[model samples]
Structures are given as C-alpha cells and as structure tokens.
Target: MATGLILIFDKTHFSKYFVVPSTLGALLALAIPDLEGGAHDDIIYNGLNPNAVNNSKKYGINWGYDSHLFWEFLITHFLSLVLPFFLQIIQPKEEKITIKVLWKSIYLTFSVALFLFFFSWIIYAIVEKHGSPAQQISWNANWFYMGHKGISTLGELTKWPYNIISLTIIFFVLFWLVFVIKIYFEIYSFNLSYQNRKIRFFYIKRLKKTVFKENVIKSKH
Candidate 1:
C-alpha cells in the first residue's frame, strides 16, 4: 500500500503539496487517540499484560470516561480526508511564494490541525452525556481489560451497539491507513528524489555504497 502511494505521488507533479499536508494529517490521526482518557495505557497494562496491575484503577482514573470512540473515529477520519483540500484552500494566490505566504501557511496549518482536534473533542463532550446504556456498560466492562488478547473493546464488539461502534471504528481505521501510507512515501521520496545539495549527496553516497556491496557479492558468486 505504501509502495503504491509512493509511486502515485512520485510520478505526479503535485508531489510536494501532497507530502507535507498528508504527513501532517497522518500524524494527527495517530495522535488524537491518545486523548481518549488514557484507554491505550489500560489496553497495554491491563489487557495485554496479565501480571501487570490495573494502572487505571491504581491511578484513580475513571475508565473510559472520556472515550467517545465512535465520534472520535468519525471526526479524525473525516478530517484526514479533507485536510489536503483545506490546506490547498489556504494557499496564497500569488504566483511567487514569499516569506509572508510561508508564515501564513504555517499559521493556517496549525489552525486547521487545532480545529479538527477541538471540533471532535467538542462533539465527544456534547454527546457523551447521552451515550446509550450499551455504550456505558460496554465501556466499563472493557476498561482495564483483564488480560484480553486484543483491543480493550474487543469483547464488547460481540454485542449490540458495541458491535455497531466497533464497526465504525474499523471503518475509520482502514480509511486513515491510506494517509499513513502517504506519510511513508513522503519520507522515502524526500530521500530518494530531493535535489538539495547536501541531501542529494548523502543519498547518492549511500546508493553507491549499496551498489558496491551488491557487485562484490556477484563477483564472489
């Protein structure tokens, strides 16, 4: 998947525009989940590690209290889809890029990033109070996952409402993987194709070394 995305962007004229923005979007998708009331820690310590004590309980953190997993899944996935377009919208109209445009771009990128995060957080807050009985019960049950082999929510996913919620989360996770692939290509293509003097020299030197090793192996064979 990453190889395919790299080929697509590397062959395109707009690769530069795609790289930074898509990388940013992928990073945000990876990070926003951390704010879900430390459920990740619970999953690790409680679910994955049988011998480990229940960290959430020890720390007195209310389990799954801040997790509107379904909503979070939606917002971040949606934002990743639209982030590239939003970045384009904020680009200056002037043909020549200037310092001012650079500054503005930085400012707008941060603004959009913040807006995506806060918008999801706000939605989570508003609707959290109205979580269905199934959601509440499942969350409590799944929290501090008592030696589960999979995700904290894995057990809950077998039942109603939780089944639906888990499905939504899965949908978004697959959706976000596309942008993550682009991030890999962004780093890869930068190293392989960038023309900057220092970067080009470094990659060229590495390539020569690799080719030299391959030739030595072929000669021995």
Candidate 2:
C-alpha cells in the first residue's frame, strides 16, 4: 500500500464555508441542555432550555440521548479537525485497510475533549462561588453552568457515594463516545467504494538523491 497525505477540505475556504460555522455549531450544541433528566445530563445541562423543550414537544421532535450523542461526536470530531488545521499539524487520514489512523484520531480527540470538560467545570465553580447573585442566576440560566446546583443536588441524595458514582458514570460515557466514533469510521470506510472514494491522499514529498548529494558536498567544503 502506498503511503499518502490526506486533504480534508480547501484551506482557502477555512473562513467562509468551513471552520467558522462548524465551530459555532459545535459550541451551540455543547451549550444545549440534555432532553431527559439524569445526574450527568443535569451536570452538563445545568439549566435546561425551555424553548428547546417546548419546541420538541410541539413539533413532536424526538431529541433524546441519540441527539446528544451526535452532538458529542460532532464536538469531538470538530475539535480533532479544527485544532490540527489551526496548528498546521497534518494527521494521517484514515485509510480503509488500516484502523490505526482511526485509533490515533480518537485517542487525541478524547484527551482534548476530556480536558475541555474539566476546564468548563472549574470555570463553573469559580463563577458560582464568587460571582454576584445576578451573575450566579444568569450563569445557572445557561446550559454551561455545572456548579452548586447540580453538585449540591447530588450531595443531598440520601448520603450516597455520588462523587464515586458520578466518576464511574463519566468513565463509561467517555468510553461509549470513543466506541461510537470508532463505529462511525468503520461505516465510513465500508461505504467508500460506492461513493467513488472522495477522500484523496498524496504522497509526502522528499528531496531527490542528487540534491541531497549536492548539499552534502557543499557542506563538506
């Protein structure tokens, strides 16, 4: 098999049609509350969006666990792609025959996403504890708040070991997210043949032997 470089999209179109919109979408999705009530979901979606809730009911829209899962995947994948693009890092594109690339991508994505989630929690705590009453209320009114309310609620629960429980649940959720991403890559690879394999990979360039020889000769003088 030939070693090749993969180009995802046009770099020139980064500002207009690509990265900006995706960044916004991922942020918005991250900021949206989960549909059903659960401790982890409550932690993530500190304040539920009433409008979203009303719309779902009115339109008969089934925005549940699956919808949240998709957003999580989008967030992970977007971070994986956008962060590398901005840093001028080139990741090996996923080849159909090799899953090594997929594993690498997922590992990086999961690490970054985990760091971000923890960072968000820290910020939430700082704001809730130190901010003014209005600030605290407004913060909890948004989906990003995961401070006193959620944690305190868990704390109040019949003296249960919620901290340990929450951590355990978090571990499983993250594992599941990685599994879902892997499955997605597998499906995409399986479908490549019928789609004309739009993914393009180019060989990495290297200097010719003559040029290297000339450089070495010049350096020796």
Candidate 3:
C-alpha cells in the first residue's frame, strides 16, 4: 500500500498534485481505527512492568499508559504517515510503474495484511488457552499485534462485528486494486496518445519540407 502510493505519486508527473493527498489518505486509513476504543484497554489500564528487572535495566522505563498510547500511535498512524514520505523521497526516481510494479505492490500489501491477521490469531489462541502473562505480552507488544489478534479474538468470541471489520479491510484492498488498474490504464493510454501525436507531427513536418524542396527544384529546372 505504501509502495503503491509512492510509485503512483512519486514516479509520475502527477507527483506535484497527488503526493500529499496520497500520503494523507494512507495515514488517515491507518489512524482512524485507533481513535475508537477497543482491545488496547488492557495495557492502557494496567501499565508496564515497573519493579521488574527488565524495567530496571539500562534504557528501561515503565511506560504504562504513555507507552501503550505511543505504540498505538506508531502502528495505527505514525508508520503509515512516515512510510509514504520515506518511499517518496528515498527510492530511485527512475523506477517506472509497469504492470510488474502494480502487481508487486498489491501482492506485498495483501501478504503483509494476511500475515499480520494470522499472526494475531495465533497470539489470541495462545492467550485464550494459556492466559495472563501471554495475554499481557500480546496486548502490550504493538498496536498491530493488538488490533490484528485482539480484535480477531473479540470478534470470534462475541458475534459478528469484529469479523465484519476484518472483512471490510480485505474488501477495501480489493477496491484499491481496481483503482490501481484504472490508474495504470489511464497512464498507459496517455503515454501512447502523446507518442502517436509526436510521431504524426514529425512526419507532417518532414513531408512539408520535402514538398517545398521539390517545388524549388522544379522551378529551377
């Protein structure tokens, strides 16, 4: 998803117009979920290990609520905000948006999302079967960990709402794929039209010059 936006906006002439909006759109997609209440409550309410040896280790601090919120902010929004800009500026500008580029982006996003989903499910299963420390670990790790696994577990145990959200994200990706295809076709058509126009104009100019030279030769003869 991040790569796709970068390629679409960064590699194209449209970058001047689309880059900021595409970046903001990606950030908005990631951030909106965190604003609402969900599984993060456990970490937010309880806090991190203060007295533990790990907490006392160098660079260790009991993050508690702040830590939880920080992680939530990072995963849910910050990473998304950072990634598009990073890709936009860092990647080689010469990269072209071929079909390979488009499909690769789609595949990468789906693969990452699916892996996160299943990884969360496994964590939830462990927490459900074993309990507590594991659950705590799962909750505290990162927003992606919680959002993917915790919400999935919640949906399974409760009813249908959680599942619906998961499914909706998947479908949204599908919709994005359609949009990507449309953009590719539009770019392709525009390029082809421009090339054809240039070629025709070149031929027309050459033909006019040839005819003018022929008339000059005839007049001299």
Candidate 4:
C-alpha cells in the first residue's frame, strides 16, 4: 500500500492531485480505526517457535472489540476508491488521470516491493529454523497479509524472519523514496515543457489575428 501510494504521486500532473486526496482517505481509513479503538487487521503468522505462537492468544484485533474485521477490511481498501471517483467527477477532463496509469503505477511499485518481500522470505527460510518437530507452521490468508501479523507481534522482536522482513520493508521504502524524487523532477520538467509550448502557441495565435486585421484594414482602404 505504501509503495502504491508512492507510485500514484510520482507525477506533477494529475497523479499528485489525484493521489494525495486518495492517500488522505487511506490514512483516515487506517487512523480512524485506531482512533475509534479499533485494531489494524494483520496476517496471522505461524511462528518459527511454538512458545511465541502460543503467546499470541489472538491472531488479530480482538473479535469482540468495536474494530470488527468486516469494517476494517472495507475501510482499509474500499475507501480509497471513493477519492478517485470524486476527483474524476469534479476535476477537469484535461487534468484527469487514467485508470491505466493508476494500475501501471500500482503494478510497477508492487512488483518491486514484492521482489524485496520474496527475496527476504528466501533468506529467512534459509536461516530461520522452523517450529519444533511437533509444531506446525502455518499462515492464514484470510487477511492476505496486507494487515497485521500473528499473535507474537511483540515476540517478532527476537525472531529471525522479523529482522529480514523489516529490512525488506525498509529497503522498499528507501528505494521508493528515491524513485519518487526522480519522477517528481521529471514531472516538473514535463509540465514546464507544456507551459512553454502553450506560451509559444499563444504568441503565434496573436500574430495570426494581428495579420488578419491589418490585411482587412488595408483592403478597406
């Protein structure tokens, strides 16, 4: 999601205008839940250590709490769709962003981020020991890992996959920051070129009108 947002805002064109408000919606989606005493939805991770998994009594936010899984799921993902829809309605046609661009941005960013995640997963598999012979390692896909992870949230502090995943996330964020910065400058330059063309076109148009007026007056004389 973070990477997706970065991609969306990578242009000075409609992307920034479109991306920012939508991002706000996303932020609100995340923040409102926590503010209203809700917990973030997360993945339920089967731990490498049985003791750690046992420590996590629940997989995610308390089921009985005000933060129900249903609402959390809706708010976190769907609310973002509203912002772009409203922007499309009120925003000018020329400045409008296309769904293709949005999808491309999201796909490109996700591909890069996913690479990091998978790469780290490989490292973790090699280095991190699985649970004891009697313990089973399992991951719940209900949340699809976009949310929070299993019981040992704090217990992740001592785990091996913990650091690798953390590093992977951090790497994506840093790489994404640099990528956005480059795109920002490119967007600025692109817009500047457009502005220059508009200015030149305006002068050429005035010149044509002036010449036409001069010819009409001469003909009248």
| Model 1: lDDT to the true structure | 0.40
List TM-scores for all candidates, in order. 0.26, 0.30, 0.42, 0.30
For model 4, how many clashes?
Answer: 5
Highest lDDT against the true fold, candidate:
3
Sort by lDDT, top down from the best: 3, 4, 1, 2
**lDDT tens string, model 4, 154-178?**
3563134353355345434644463
The number of clashing residue pairs in model 1 is 0
Q: After superposition, how far is residue 216 of candidate 4 from its true place, in Å?
A: 41
Q: Least lDDT summed over 10 consecutive residues: which range in candidate 3?
A: 199-208
Worst 10-residue lDDT window for candidate 1 reads 141-150
lDDT of 2 by residue, 105-197 (tens): 335444543454465566667777797644554554222122333333234531222332453354336544644553444334432222465
Note the residue pairs that clash in candidate 2: none
Report lDDT (CA) for all predictions: 0.40, 0.40, 0.44, 0.40
For model 3, residues 1-221, the per-residue Cα lDDT tens digits are: 44446456744432322333344445445544433333334333456453443523323134334667547645645554565455545543433333344445445545654566666666656665677753545443333322333443334732222533554464457545644654444333322235644743222123444444432343343
